[model samples]
Target: MSKVFLSAKLPAATTKILTDHGLTVSVYAGEGLISHAELLKSVVDVDYLITPLSTQVDAAVIDAAPKLKLIANFGAGFNNIDAAYAKTKGIQVTNTPAVSTNSVAEVTVGLMLALSHRIVEGDAQMRTSGFPGWAPLYFLGSEIAGKTLGIVGFGNIGREVARKARALAVNVQYWQPHRLTDPEERSLGVQYVEFADLVQTSDFISINAPQKPDNHHQFSAAVFKEMKATAFLINVGRGPIVDEAALLTALQQGVIGGAALDVYEHEPQVTAGLEKLNNVILTPHIGNATVEARAAMGTIVANNVVLLEQGHNAKFIVNA
Candidate 1:
């Protein structure tokens, strides 16, 4: 049987699909993300390597896998995998795109509402001190019904977010590297705005961009300063998209109103002082944490492995 190594355990259904096809699947032992050293060792003999974005599949990992023919990533983003380097070695890389579009977009909107309404903070307060029946000024939070929402990346997830935000009566504006056609803009009910204008004018700014050289620390001190003091920042995208140090400063100085973050610049290990603040809500990366999405990604990973092994290109091949 051809060997397949998984850096992390995906849904059982996905694993079964691969195993049923007569492929041996080995998942890393123990909990949490597989350590760097272990991952390198595990890939040395595998024909197909399945990994999460947290694991780095660079030149070293690619070089170690002498029999590696395919690198099937479990998530939409393939930044962790060195696809270009893999191409030189004739090893293809594929990611499960669009599977998490609705899931991530749903989390983005949930984060927006959580921050706007201080849901997490309020819950904590109630648990600790108990809410006294009904007080007029106990916890006054902003409403999202009539606010402007600026989406950073107007891709599938961003468009889904726009569609949801419109249902809430929130005015939607988007800023992207490439503007959509006028007709597409009208259909989506979004107005294209300059990046600077979007940051300055929006009541809530959501970062939905991918990790790119130009997008690193895109939300820094200067950008946060330009945000309306009463505005909130929501990030469900790549962590490095926002500068952690600068965000801390902004929260401390009241540079912006508040922030709700799903991803962080340094993931799993959060930046210091983020949890202590009362104005911010931090979450483990749950953008695509739903069972449905994970199961779908598992299926996609299975398909990528089976198809690539059978001399067929995966539908989501990153290096075809």
Candidate 2:
């Protein structure tokens, strides 16, 4: 039987898929991330390793598992694993994509609404100090219906956001490295623009891009300055894509109207002073936290393992 090591806890249905296929699986049942030393020791004799996206499976971790054939990530993004190094080591890297598309897209829109409408602020006020009572200008907030929403990285999640935002009468525009064909844009009811135009013209901006070397700190102070004074920023994508220090500065100085982040520049460690700001809403990376998305990710990850064990090319393989 092929031996597998799961680095974190997952849904029982996910493990069942492996055991039912006659694979031996050992899972780390701890409350937090598995330590690097523990991970290095666990993979010594394992053939397949499954891990959460937050866990770093770097070159050292890849080297620790000489017999490892696959690294199945339990999230849509695969940047946690070093695919280039894994390919050299003849290890297949796979991620569960599209499984979290709807969930993440929904959360993206939710963040937009929460930030624009002062939903979180109002809720906090009600809980902490009691309601101040209603007045025309008591809790002024923006509406989504007439504002232009710019989405960065027009992939599955981005496209979904466009569809949903359009239903709310939002003028949705998008920018990615490659421009979509006219027909594709028309079908999605979105307009394709350059990155500069998207940042400058949008009333609200959403980041759904992946973490690539080129994308690290892509949203810098200069970029923030280009945005409208009343514009809002929402990031449901990778954290490192936006420089938190710069973002904090922007938020503090009113460089932009407001901002919301589900992911941070550093995992588990948020930049200081962000929580103290009323203009920003910070959520623990919960873009894919929905029950449906988590379950679906588990299923997709389990299916990939089964496929690889059967000597077939697994689905969503990032490394050849």
- Best model number under lDDT: 2
Local error of candidate 1 at residue 195 (angstroms): 0.5
Clash number by candidate, in order: 0, 0
Candidate 2 lDDT (Cα, whole model)? 0.92
Off by over 4 Å in 2: none
The weakest ten consecutive residues by lDDT in model 2 span: 130-139
Per-residue CA lDDT of model 2 for 242-281, tens digit only, reads 9999999998999999999999899889999999999899
What TM-score, over all chains together, does every model reach? 0.98, 0.98
RMSD of 1: 0.9
